[model samples]
Target: QLMSVVAVGDQLVQQQHFGAERIQERLQDTLGNWNHLLDLAALRRKRLEEAVDFHQFFADADDVDIWMLDTLRLVSSEDVGRDEANVQSLLKKHKDATEELKNYASTIEALHTQAGQLGEQDRTAPEVVERLNSIDHRYQELLELAKLRKQRLLDALSLYKLFSEADGVEQWIGEKDRMLQTMVPAKDIEDVEIMKHRYDGFDKEMNANASRVAVVNQLARQLLHVEHPNCEQIVARQNQLNHEWAELREKAEGKREELNSAHGVQSFHIECRETISWIEDKKRILQSTDSLEMDLTGIMTLQRRLSGMERDLAAIQAKLDSLEAEADAIEAEHPEEAAVIRERITQITQIWEQLTQMLKERDSKLEEAGDLHRFLRDLDHFQAWLTKTQTDVASEDIPGSLADAERLLNQHQAIREEIDNYTDDYTKMMEYGENITAEPSTQQDPQYMFLRERLKALRDGWQELHQMWENRQQLLSQSLNLQMYNRDTRQAEVLLSQQEHVLSKDDAVMNLEQAENLIKRHEAFLTTMEANDDKINSVVQFAGRLCDEGHFAADKVSKKAENIADRRNANRERALQQMEKLKDQLLLHQFLQDCEELGEWVQEKKFIAQDETYRSAKTVHSKWTRHQAFEAEIASNKDRLVRVQQAGEELMKEKPELAELIAPKIKELQQQFQ
Candidate 1:
């Protein structure tokens, strides 16, 4: 109604009616006063309701607080069970208690809500607020205690469950371990196969139980993840389970490998036996027919049979290789029996090798027998060639010249080449004779004795022929050396005579330049003379060597060497005298030239020192430094001057004739020095 009146007044005022403003103001003032009175009356009613609510709140709060105290005592109880069953039973009761606490949650919330309402109504009422806070505090404590109690129960249950599960797994592992430990190893193939089949099933069963063990591990991990009170025990149980599980697996795998190796070894042994029997049979066949027949047909039959046997042996080799591989694997799998197994393998291998050897020897003997007639034909041919070669090698013709001797040596070498061409035939025949004589059946044959005698005669003839060829070759080589020596001696003597004639020439030098040229010419002449001397010495040495080697012309070579040595000594002495004369003239010329050079150097230094450029202050120090360097240079040339003077004096003494030549240079140099 007041809203409608206010709406009507607002419309009249907006329309500017005559009394609308006055009436609106008066109505607003009256409503204000009425609202103030209603506020007072509401405050009075709220106080009355708050008094009643405060008492009721206290009552509900006290009730909840009392129940919480009892619940706290129950939650704080240390009655965690010692076993799975006990813990499980306690867990169930704790669960029921938890449910009851949850049921009371709403009632407690309601009372809390009431307290809030009462406090909201009268904020100055500390007692009501305090009581409400105390109830809330107790409620929170009860909740935490209950939660902790439930966790403890759960921890205990989980611990017990883990223990139970771990015990079961351990029991299972132990049972399996004992079974594996106590199992009898297979002794044969059949037994191994049966055992392997059973172990496979057992392994699968063990693998299937792995999930059960995993469950136990998962339970333990959960307890650990949550940090259960029995964390130490949980970890210990987990480690033990893991250790035992690993060990059990190891044992199972070991047993499996053991059985497998047993089967492989047993199979290997059986195959080895079969291979051995086969090898023995083949060996007997080889031995029975090992005898060689004198006829081609019989020998061919034996060869074909041996070839067939070899093919069979080759086929059996694959089986042996397989058996060996199997044996290796078994040995790798089981080391304790490796030696025995390998010994057996080695014995069988030895037998196989022996059979192979027998086959090889038989084949060789057959081949040798087949080659007998060819051997005899080659022997006869070789013997005839040896006899003819002996006649050629033993020829008594002596070479008289280098060409003849060289021709003879070349002919001997050709004979040697021919002998070399038949060397393989000779070796083959000798081997044939030895083979025939060495055979047990043929040892007493007259043909064998003849072959032996023929071989001995051939060897002796070959040795004699070789020695004859060597002797003839040595004679021819020595004849060639003698001819070379004679030719070299003649040539050396001619060269020495030419060089000696050159050295005896009367060459004269006019001036220093002419003397230098003459000295160079003399040096050249001496070089030529030295070469001639070397040649003559070589001739003499060659003659001496020929004498040492007992050459047929040693006496002639010695006389030629004496003549050549005399000529060589005379030429050398004359050449030395010529060189000394030329050198003395050259020295005189060099001394005169040195004296002239020293005089010029002295004059040059005197000119440089006589300069007067040191008068200026600015140029004084530099000029003095240059002047001092010039003086030091002149001082250094004093040695050159003294050396030149001494050389001039020495030349004047050595050759009094050169004193007239170098006296002016020495005097002028002395003047320059003074």
Candidate 2:
């Protein structure tokens, strides 16, 4: 529009209108000056905005540069720490500085952005790029220096941790070593056993300490590998710990050996004293002087006593031999006590020999007295004949057939008749013995009392023979009659024997499958036994009925029936017990299996719960989200854990024996869960 106006004005000027040329020239000049002033003002505003941007960049960069210098000084400090507490304090300060530096990351980023904008407006602004670069370089240096300082402080803290741990273990070692020095040598077997048991507990603790020390050493090695500042101190602490531990072990081992030796020596002394006391008792008995009897009975009694003493002496001799063997072992291990042990053994052997000699002399005196008595010769012959007759009576077995049983009965009758004939002879001998004892000279003699005793024994033996013959005759007759009635009794006996063998088996159940199989097998066997119940009952009833009918073998039949009934009842009870035991075992096995499965699931959850690798998330939000998910999983699974605990408690309430096995597992799981 202005150009159109200028063109119209020029045309008017050319037409020579009044003042057209002057107005056109003045409009051109005025338009030119207005355009120049507008351009100048626009130029001035652009320059002012650029100046603001540059000064803003400078202000931000200078602030960051000042921070870098201060942080550099802080990071560059050579002081690691004076001690653990000091190191921790310095570490905390370094951590705060590191966080402050991290906060500056955004400020530095904003500076880069502003510098980029400035560079884009004018590529020649090298100052902005150079200042930004300088600030970036200083920030990176601060980061590295801060990192180095933090690491140094951490290394110092780790070194102190080693010192603390090693000091604690060394203190424990010192206490234990003092305790070991106070442990006196045991005076007896029981004392030694107690001491050794306590020592074993210490040994276990020492083993655990060894592991702790190993961990300390391993940390020391790690620090050394990193070229820790206190290398010499770490080496010194490591060597001191290892050396103290070695010394403690040496002292413990020496005490163990000493206790063992003392135990062996004390055991030998106690056994030796007991043996000597026993020998003295035997000697007193041997040396006793009761009035001697010249009668045959007294001589025989003396001989029997001598024979028993000889047997006792033989047993004592065996004990001495064992003691000698033990002493040999003790001497081999502990030679210093060999003399005392040998002397005690020698004393025991001498006393034992003296007792043997005493026994021999007593035996010889009894033998000589026996030779002087004429009545002893006859009494010996009679006793020999009596023993033979008793053997014949006692040797009869149950007859297999009726004829054989009847024959045995007839033979028993003849033996009874012979015993009756001997009864008269026994009476005459007793009269003769009484008459000899009635003589005044014989009455005054110690042998007279022995004569009366001999007579009484002969009469008792004669009576015992009569009673034994009568019993044998009765048994033979019963056998003859029992042959016909033994079929039912024999069948029950055979069945009981078979069932006894079956019930005797005691196989152990090892697993759920085995327990179940055993229970099934037992149930089947019980079923079979149940089916045989009627057969067993019928046999008992039949025998009982025969007894009620006054059968010839009624007594024997009744006894046999009662025995069969008792055995059948016993076997039934046993079968029921076996089935119950198997079922219980199966229950136990199933419970253990369920517990094992639950334990494995709990263990899996524990492994996941104990994980500390959430730092894998690069951002705080990612880490927080992952942790929240983890917490949710734990909360969801809590009910499952509670169910496991409830199940364990219920199982313990139901089966008390399982409490011994499962309580510890439950408690451990509960602790880990907490």
Candidate 3:
């Protein structure tokens, strides 16, 4: 029983350890937190520029606030710093604490490792309290100093981005300007002058743009404080370092005040221990931070984003150049249209205002680019939008309307040439070949045939169309009426004096054939009033129906009725009195000899109203009557239209080559009011 009691006592002696081991564990834990401490500092530094009021934020970062909450980690249960109790009586009582703890832990670990070994019970624990107490002075000081240095190092690491190569941006800007100048021509005096002005503008713009990037970088840096090197030399030898510091601190604390060193030896011992402890601490820290150290994911993303941003900027610049070149080419081709182009240029000048505002918005968005990849993606989008906006204005375009106009002009010019040729031939005959002959030529000249063709065409237009109502429905009747009833027919004019015939012949060149060709061309040249004429009558009828149903005037009626009713109705009574002048027109018309009175007061007493210059009621009445007759004829013209259409088709085929050209002008005249 005594032997068993001794064995149990021996076991108790071998297994015992005190607070010294716990202190080392606590220190290791403190070092572990340091990894996150440095990371949080970095985050703060990165975000500070955009978060100038970060301190004002009431919600603290969850895991990230650890560094700023430093007091939570380093303070002990005694409401003092970890190393604050160096001079306490209980602390001093543990004189052998440091060495004993190390020896005890080693033995215990060996025991557990060799649990089945023979005679393991013979092993004894060291005097833990005395050894730990002995090393307390050195290890405590070392741990405290390491903590302070680590804090400072973390501060420096937080601000690494601020010390970028972009600090030399001004130098880069200067070089860029020099490159821009070199790219421009300097040989021509005006070019040199323009380049000089451009250089000045570039200088200012670069300064402004550069300053923006710099200010942001500077703001980011402002929140970072310099770091102290809390790191110790890392290696497997660090265990020895911790052991040595523990011994030194234990020895020195026995001989001096807790806060200050005595002899230089004490201070040296304190420092050595600290350096050694830091090395051990660093080894542990390296273990915890290895994952973070190996990871370059965030930084690499930032770099990639920045690269993308640069590419986007380059693309935008290329697109802008393309737009500018197209605009310049368009301007160069139409020098006579310079006024219109200048107006477009003025419109483009307003684009600068819009671009400036857009750039201001872009500047704001740039700050949101947290990493290089995000920045690049955003830049691409911005560039595409910019390109689209610029392309909308400066892109090359075909002026279809102008092309149509030019084609019409060419047709007119060709007709003018033909007319000029005909006139030239006439002038030649008049000037050189012959006197004005009273008889037809005996010679069968081809030129005369051509002249006769032109005269016949002219006669067709004047006689068939303008000679009285010669509707083709009654061709014989029309011909008789034109020949006999209408005194002004071209055929009748053929019976006039020889001079009259010559004059009429001259007027007969633009015949129905030419008019038909002109009409066809004009129809093609003019813009269609509607997509097709099929809906024209329907649209008009629908609009008229709406107007009639509503008792409301249409735009056409409103505009015309306002003019007539407002101008004429207000003067109705005065206008009736003004009709006394019309009697004068009747009086001046000695046309009807001895005209009766207009209202039959007395035929001879009326004295013919004596004013031929006055506005004539007969003219107005004749116009109204002619319009009514034409309307009536139009109302009864179904068969006449069919006959005229057949005749038109027949004549059109006779000159099919020029038929397309003449159809438009003929259609124009034919489609007009009588």
Candidate 4:
């Protein structure tokens, strides 16, 4: 019935298209119904993003909770491990969380991007176009939030590295100074002589540098308030220098104290950290001796275990051999089924080889894929950076696109307004046979007055909806059945509107497909990578076994060789001590019968001149040794300092921006010296 009415109206629309009011009504109804469907589809797509965002929120919250719990556990521990003040772990945890959030934010950002793409499909639908604007606005706000969050994390991390390093340096310096004060007086005569060579300026310089670092760190933090990247980069560079300087100073101070104490020391100078470190290693080796023996026993157990696997493989091979022989004997006995048996055997063997090769390739590919994972991840991010920084993708330019959209939107606005102006309520009521009219008229009977006045106003245009409904009854009939063409028509309109909204997304989708496909492959590739890792681990273990075999022989030789070298190095100091002892006994032997020879011996001693000026030769000799030792130590410190400087230079090279920021300060310091 509705179709017959629409067919009558369709004949009129065929003559007038939308130029006539009746035809225009049908157009509006169809377009409105179409827009509604498009809106629903867009809504469905948007809900997916909301779902993803909800998932991300819960996951991120869980991660934050886990991190807080882990940190709390360590903080609450009554018996803290050596790494109680593990700044690295703290930094790493913070870094990981920051990065994870960035990843999630980026994904949300990508969805925002996808929504933008979806928006492009709704250009013809005014309602969808409006909704697109709303989404873009929301995303722009979210984008700003994400960027600020990342920047804040970076600022916190920079400050943390500086202060954390300062704390470590301070602790180290305190312990070093304590060690210097608590160390016992020089024992051996030769040790006292050696001490003189190595004890100047190390502590003094460290104390000064520690002070410098503290001041510099405070200055940097104060200066780090600027929001600009240049200012931030400058402060971070300065803070880094403070950290490096603090490390160098404390290490240098400790090394100096060590040098001073090492003079005329025992067989191994505990001052040479490597010496004590080696001793500790030896002790640890002794401690783990039982474990090593157990490991040897386990190796035998492993060999015994290998026998079982070998037997299993051998049994499998034997079954295959027996099956082949049985097939041959069957063929000889009954030739009729010989061909079928041969065919089956061939098929089985072929399938086995194919399975083995596939397994091998799967393992190999997985490893290869794993090795590329980091590179792929970096590459992926680099691509993301490109997308983020794309010249065409402008948040600012969206307004312009929207302006174009709004212009078209307003044209529809004009059309709606024009229709609204003419369709007065009273004019439509008379056409619909209601007891109302456009004009206030005097008639004794209310019904006649209402009907006559409304009829007189029937020539009024499409301002009123009732007039639209009454005059265009055929249009209304057609509209009531709009559900028939609802989905297909609206979806197409919505899709068209979105593309025109943001032109860049249409441009970006050309690239997004490739990336999406690659991401899809990532999960499968990760599994393969794990399998490959096992193979690589096996190779590593085999290499370690080979090294262990060589180390067994090398260990025996090292034990013998290192001892001989130790004895040889100790020879010079032992001789110096002996001479001091001999000289000390000189006074006791003075009344010997061979007085002249004794006098000559005394004369030839380094401490005494031939002129016999009552020389305390031993004292003088010890003083000279002290002077020489002090000079050597200073030289060693200078050499060590050069090493630290070189390392710092190399570090600065990698972070060249740091050099650009710091070189001015260094130059100013140099000029002050000059």
Better of 2 and 3 by TM-score: 2
Model 1 global lDDT (CA atoms, 0 to 1): 0.80
Q: Candidate 3: list runs displaced more than 4 Å.
A: 1-151, 154-160, 180-674
lDDT of 2 by residue, 236-331 (tens): 999999999899999999988888778778878988999989889888876762455645446656654554566677778889989999999888
> For candidate 4, which ten residues in a row score worst on lDDT?
391-400
Q: Tell me model 3's lDDT, rounded to 2 decimals.
A: 0.38
User: lDDT (0-100) at residue 651 of candidate 1?
Assistant: 86
Ranking by lDDT: 1, 2, 4, 3
TM-score, every prediction: 0.38, 0.49, 0.17, 0.19
- lDDT by residue for model 4 over 118-233, one digit each (tens)? 33333224543444454445445444544554454455555555555556666665665555554443556465545443335445656666675676566466646655344665
- Cα lDDT for residue 583, model 3? 28
Candidate 2: global Cα-lDDT?
Answer: 0.79
Q: 593 in model 2: Cα distance from truth in Å? A: 74
User: Ten-residue segment with the worst summed lDDT in candidate 1?
Assistant: 292-301
- Clash pairs detected, candidate 2: none
Give the per-residue Cα lDDT of candidate 3 at 289.
30
Using TM-score, rank the candidates from best to worst.
Answer: 2, 1, 4, 3
lDDT of each: 0.80, 0.79, 0.38, 0.44
